[model samples]
Target chain A: MPSSSSSSAPTPAAPSKMYADDVSVVVVLLDANPFFWSSAASPLPFSSFLSHVLPFLNSVLLMNQMNQLVVIATGRNYCDYIYDSSAPTNRKTGNGKMTALSCDLVAKLEEFVVKDEKLGKGESNGAVMSSLLSGSLSMALCFIQRIFRSGTFHPHPRILCLHGSPDGPEQYVAIMNAIFSAQRSMVPIDSCYIGALNSAFLQQASYITGGVYLKPQLMDGLLQYLTTVFATDLHSRAFLQLPKSVGVDFRASCFCHKKTIDMGYICSVCISIFCKHHKKCLTCGSVFGQAQSDAASETNKRKTIRT
Target chain B: MPEVRIVARNFMDMVASLPAMKLDQLYQNAFICQAIVRSLPPLAKKYVIQMLYVEEVVPGKLIEEWVLPDGSTKYRVAIDRLVQLRIFSETFDRTSGTSYRLNPTFRVNLQKHITIGGVLPREPMSATITVRLPSLEDLEVYAHEQWECFLLQLINSAQSERMTNISPAMMRIFQRGLLTQREKDAPRLTESGFQFLLMDTNAQLWYIIREYILNSEELDIDSADLIAFLLELSFHATGEAYNMNTLDEIQRITIKDLADLGLVKLQQGRKDSWFIPTKLATNLSVSLTDSSARKEGFIVVETNFRMYAYSTSKLHCEILRLFSRIEYQLPNLIVGAITKESLYSAFENGITAEQIVSFLQQNAHPRVAERIPSVPENVTDQIRLWEADLNRVEMTPAHFYDEFPSRDVFEAACDFARECGGLLWEDSKKMRLAVKTEVHMQMREHLRGQR
Candidate 1:
């Protein structure tokens, strides 16, 4: 009711509003991090995750008759298409197609975890990390491009990344590249973080792509948050006044060790981030102080590379 | 004017004609309500969803605020359509105070559909039918074949001989004595049939299905039950066979009828049977205005009026014949030309230039479809001009008067005719004047009153 009364005035010539029924293609990126989920700090338990995600996917699919869904899992070994509605209508004729897809997704995730465990069994505190956001996003973009380039009624695609685990610092460049391409294609990359802290990479992805990034206070209302905030298509999103993000986390992860940093030093030539002073750049192998020892020269170099 | 004919009523229009109480009753059926919501104009559907959970009648001013400043006209139009459908109830309150709300049953039903995914009247098909269900592709083929036969029968295309028989119930519905003569041996195509061919697939489907619903009374199938069943069929999985046992007597009969019509395909199993929804049935609940999705093949129309239709469907070829004269046909290509003779015949058969152009544009080859104006400008305009030529000399109700005694009298009559605003033609050489038939008496009285 804030600007309710004042917004009621009519314009001289009302534009002919058209609510288009363009097909919506949604690619869901699930972070299959076993280590994160097994930890008690995680709000979304693996079991809780399956229940919410499946229903949310179904609801999204049911929202429009022309809607298409593709679910990609970032497993330890590799990223794979877990479920795709565009694939030949489910071959398993006995089970309901949706339930069949759901079971297949569950089985695949379980199999991925078991495989990861076996691979990590030998070493002490061996970590099984598998949140390949970049790979999944690239694949999603390719899939969108393929469908849209040929068809008469190409669907408007949006990617939803459910990030529970930490960011993959190694994929910093790849992730940013994907976000920019997605932004260029008008494909919003919505991210829902269910874990402890905010993901710097995901926050920027959502912001740049004009999609919603939500961190719910109550993990129990994850489905509610998804259906209400993120379920809307690109057209409806225009009219909706979304939850205002207080501030964007503009901090960049260091290129050298893939670690998040504040007040980081950078190599001017390569534009690579470093936690502290280094002679040789790890990214592009650029020698920094060896070439220019003066502090004023270093300041000039940094000034040229201002982001 | 030649002979009074009943204006056609499409399925949606028939539903729109139902009283509020009947609409309320129909809305109680969740599938019917959902289908109505889905098929409504996009703006109207948006309005319905916005008001779905609102507690009370929202003020008209609030509606205006919801859309952009330039969207007020769309808001009003959307509301008007909603009111017509009895989905949105409008209450007058002088100027900006007017308020509206969803019809109670429609709100509850659509809400249940969107939120909880309302329980189906019939349970999901048990394991028995699923094992032997037809593949999606086969179901699609069967459905398409059946629908093609049905259309072929209506137009009495050469392929109608291939069809076994069209159901009497359908025949009764299709033939309303409008332009159709109920002759059995050779069902000649009427002007309406030509116009029907020019309509897009979605519109044709709606027209045919609505005709069925309208004739439901004579067929002894309740209109409400038929609508509810058809709408429910749309929500079901396409190409998946469901247990026929789950359907009641009325639904089972309707399913058989629908299967015959190619909306659904029925597969016989060991113990029982199952009905698999085809694309036609599955698309029933989709937006009626989804014209863009119906782009099947490219029908290329060149500037020289040569038409090349790259389609394998006989139905497409037969429809093309309604406007363009076919020169020859190959396995996957049809060569035709839009000639003056063809255009005149098409125009005479009640096919408007707009419909012909739209049909051409819709079926335009991908290369042509992508062009700014899908059809060549010269061809579209020429077609329109041909149709316009038929209407050039408009008949009017006017009386011609001549031979005034003097120039002043002639001037007076001319003045009277002009003042009446009914003068069709005037000539000073012969001092003749024409006045409308309705105004003739008034003019005569005015002249006498002046005298």
Candidate 2:
């Protein structure tokens, strides 16, 4: 089977590559920065991201017969599943009620939000990456688990994400767990961080998970990037030469300061990274005594505290 | 490293055992298969849907009337593919020409797939399916390393085994029919092997999985179970871990083969736990033609007959070596030339100029891809001309029919042969016409005792 991407010309069509019908579940994560999206001249507006990426999502929907699209908004306590308001097929469910088109999807997404809020919103300034990651991943896992039970498990359902923020340092471990979940599951994560100045966490998400991570330089050309970068299903990405970031920032976030750091002291017990010179591991509560050689020179140097 | 002929032979051998045949064949005698039920193009699939509830297969001639005369070609192609693949069949009658019939199992499954809106009816029903569960960890690992190992195995096979980057278990899978081994010596590519290398990432994975499924039956596993699992895996989302509790006994057993092929990640001693279907597993059924439009970087061919690929993956480089003579490789750049010698070498290995040209155009980088003709017209023409130099003669083995009682009979048979592109050579003299196709020979039998 020819696995070339373009079929317009006389190129060998890769017949066995992944098609839209091969998709089982499609998870779409939208960046809900309404303040930024609503601003008159926001650097990266939500509407722009939507207009740029939705067509690609629609293209994906158009490709598969059994394909499903689940859109989730990630900002504050604002997790909502958006409907594909245009789908004629969706209109038939629940006796022609469009809302019924998203019944199961909305219920699952709500389960995520309710469960996270119950866990008492953590200290991440209302940016719900943890909830997004946990809820989305677990729900996906649960859904897959159920399908497998019914003798209908799809091993590689695709996840198309549109986000514009770094994952919190506190949720780094959980996020990595989610990343490993994806990696181990053989799912390639395709992500587009539109108009974000700097996002180390998402870079790692795209890179670690073997998904396409594109930062659209030309904001207006968002659709092109989405269709080109995220549109190719997991199967075809192998043969067609894809553009990947050469220099990925592989740095980790410091647990102590909750800040991204170039270098940091890792706790010997838990491997929790920290930026401060500490006598004990804050995460695991392990204490360390100063060595004699270090103590002997301690009196020789004095440190000044900045106000 | 195997001889190109041997590699090609092995690939053909493997293709013979491809599990895809069962799906095709199940529909062969039958009208449709369930997994592919929802996948039929809306129009043709709609045709099938309309015919599903009916007791009779509409007469083949009626199909022409249903579709506009201008649209007959497409309708014919679809119906022919369905028949060729055995999804639909024509039943004969003494007085009438023929009527189409849907394959029984296919008709049932397709109706279910469509009527249920593609969400399979939850009822257990008569179709038998069993469940086995996998843990979260097992699912994750299965998905991660399968394709990586498969690609690594292909790359490493081209070089020395020791220098190869793939793992041992992965290598062992290659040694078995699960992954076809390129002999460690000859190092030239055969037609099928060349085609395999040139396939998109997803198709390549299926090429390997189909190979594995071909071998699975030999290990006493039910091919249907494997197929069902594969179809299920294709629907699973990426980055999600599935519980192992849902696996069937056969499916659980199949996980070992999948893991060996790097299609699934199986944690140690976690037979009952969940396993993830890697991108390779999930994309096993994706067609290869859509890769470029959805891909970021693409192949760019210059007018001077030079080629540049903007990729760093070793697998891509290995694929390039199938045709192009590589000059140098930078961090993310590969430079190659389309020389006459390389083209001749490719042809010598049984690859056609058409395959080579199409491969180049298919993988054309987006920069060069933007142009109407990805490759310069001169370069494309040269490649074809170079191929013509090698393949100077067109040869085929066929049965020749010449004797005919009358000009009317000879002319009728000749028209049929010409329509099928089977008429090789003919002489109007001596009441004889040379017909090349044996398929028409069968038709000749039908015309017997008529005139």
DockQ of 2: 0.02
Q: lDDT per residue, candidate 1, A1-307, as tens digits?
A: 0010112211111111222443467899887867778876588688888777776775555456667888888755457777887676453321332344566667777777777567656757626343667888898889888876875456577889987877777777788778777766778888898878788778878877777888888977676677666666666555544565666676666666777666567776656666667778887787766555667656754432212
Can you write out model 1's per-residue Cα lDDT over B1-451, one digit (the tens) per residue? 0111233433566778777677788888876876776556545655665565576888988776756676667677777778898887878887657888788887776655544455565555666434656777888788778877877766656766566355765665675542356556455557666666655555667777777777776778778767777888887777666789888998887788788778888878777787888888878877344433554556998999999999878888887887789999999999999998988887776767877887787678988778879889999999999889889988887887887677887787778778778777888888888888999898788767766
For model 1, state the Cα shift of residue B320 in Å.
2.8
lDDT of 2 by residue, B156-207 (tens): 4443232333446544554453233565753444566666666555555555
lDDT of residue A299 for candidate 2: 40
For candidate 1, list the clashing residue pairs, or say none: B298-B364, B298-B365, B299-B363, B299-B365
The CAPRI class of candidate 1 is: incorrect
What's the count of clashing pairs in each model shown?
4, 74
Candidate 2 residue B166 Cα shift, in angstroms, is: 10
DockQ score of the complex predicted as candidate 1: 0.17
